[model samples]
Target: MEKQGVEVVVAHHERATLRAGNMFLKIDTDQARAEIEIDAMERAPIPTPEILWRRPPVLALAALSGTALGRLGEPSTASSAAWAAVGAAVRRLHDAPLPPRPGSGIDELATELDTECEWLAANGVLSTDVITRNRRIAEAALRPWTPVFTHGDLQVAHVFIDGDEITGVLDWSEAAQGDALYDLATLTLGHPEHLGDVLTGYGTAADLDVIRAWWSLRSLRGARWLVEHGFEPNSPGCEIDILRTQALRA
Candidate 1:
């Protein structure tokens, strides 16, 4: 008999996700984080994969139906309406009741920015000129914001859609009370050209400069994490590329 092939969902720094048939097994070293993700899913307004089962270091969930909004390096083939749907979904999420935790504070993020910039320079991961220039840009995002429920790692890959409707939002482990602009910034990180569509559906004016600042902030903060996790932020269509693009726009 042929065995069902196992698919690697994601293997990263802290976790490994795999799928066999309709069930996915997410194995993590941090059980508390998994519990938090489960809690967030319960409170979230939108759809998430069904929790088939759970045990320490692993949780099993059913696979979802739709394709992701887009990948980091690829152009979104989804309609503008699809992007709008994501915007609307994010708005609903922000409006939902606050999660039990708060994300990183300004001081923490500032400290992270300094440390990551130094690491990048020390390791020769990026040029000092690139690091210094983007550091200045990232400073603007350190201001206070009225916190909202945030999908802390709201990368385009985490959002799934089918025909202009968001099917599910994934990876709730990072969900926490945080700035709404951070969510917006994360969604449109690599795709600035789609910012207007997202903002249109978001139905409000925001600090464009702050959002841009988040681009640098997010990229800098993530570079180390990605490297530690056996990924490269400097690859085309990745965080370093986003930073390069941001610099070009400056």
Candidate 2:
């Protein structure tokens, strides 16, 4: 085998992904999470990266053959049909048999949301009015809902598409039984322009207000963690922009 140069895909304290030729090596400090990710990939109905092998803390997977649907802080070049295809794939995943592991409950999410909001305020990350209004909007997501098999973290970047078809999805560590709407909300976060296209393929009516509320909730909760992880949640078209946009709409 010819030696290929390794490229750093993503790096943080918890985990790092390295790419060499057509193989991806995911190294995680937490082996339990890696085990869960492997199980989730095996159980998921939709396309996922092919697991080449696994060795304790490092998991090797064959790279998929498509570009990511989009980045968080950049405009998506994928067509509406591509986005719609991703939505359809997500619907299939949601309709699959529930995973054995349960996701975060509403109570847990509420507590985290409150904690994050307080931190954001105390750190002077955003204006009080923005945080307050966004927090109010975020409350709509705390209601009860039927749980389904969910991706849990279906960010657009995790979805891969070639033309108008979905190739595969990545990052399965968060997969579990949870609210289906949370998956939809996560997919379209920071990319509101594709909501209608996704809903068209979802083949069901969804509460837009609740989805918006999740946008607020997720942004509020993720901002601090992102900062701690050396990521910029305040970048253009990211979490902070999403929160500020909610304020402008009010």
Candidate 3:
């Protein structure tokens, strides 16, 4: 039954998401991940949308109340306090009970980075100088970190905020045990200006160098993923800009 009000929210190789009024319907290729999302949200110590129904590829959730922290490739109008709120929310999530599953291994990411960096260089999508230098910078994040309950894909669009309060965190498919700085790095990836604001709210001593390294690692791999996922990496505040910025850094 095709009625009005339902519209596409996100579409990628793994899944397609739609928004129908106050309902969010996700059709995922990985049913196991869908199950994990439902469980993770239930365990997270934050305001998450209620799961309404779940049946194989399609799962429905109630809409969280509030606007997203910000969109990708755009300037954030959200206040500094709002950013701080996100940091506080993340801190709580890190302090929560760990999920049963673990996130990507550091070795896997290191290998992926090497492969993706090679692809970029071979295809001339990005200059060799930029890719190689950033690859070197990315090495800092390869070390060990105390695993915490992390929102594996903690991007700006995933976080919802109302004034100085974090209303909810969305997209739990990638939630697992991982580095806490990686979450902060993901949230502030392209939005470098907000790093300090988030850190102020995080209220913990995090390694900025490691966070910056994660930014490089993310950008190095993101270009190809964006193309494959039908997204514009060259758009403002996206991976392309982030790479350019990384190249200019000391």
Q: Whose lDDT is greatest here?
A: 2
In the range 81-178, model 1's lDDT, one tens digit per residue, is 89988998888899999999978999999998999999999998888888888999999999999999898999999999999888898889999999
How does each model score on TM-score? 0.96, 0.97, 0.96
Candidate 1 Cα lDDT to native: 0.89
Alpha carbon lDDT of each predicted model:
0.89, 0.92, 0.90
Each prediction's number of clashing residue pairs: 0, 0, 1
After superposition, the stretches of candidate 2 with alpha carbons farther than 4 Å from their true spots are 1-3
Better of 2 and 3 by lDDT: 2
- With candidate 2 superimposed using the best TM-score fit, by how many Å does residue 218's alpha carbon deviate from the native? 0.6
lDDT of 3 by residue, 197-247 (tens): 999999998899999999998889888988878888987788977887887
lDDT, candidate 2, equals: 0.92
Q: Give the TM-score of candidate 2.
A: 0.97
Clashing pairs in 3: 73-236
Report the C-alpha displacement of residue 28, candidate 3, in angstroms. 0.9
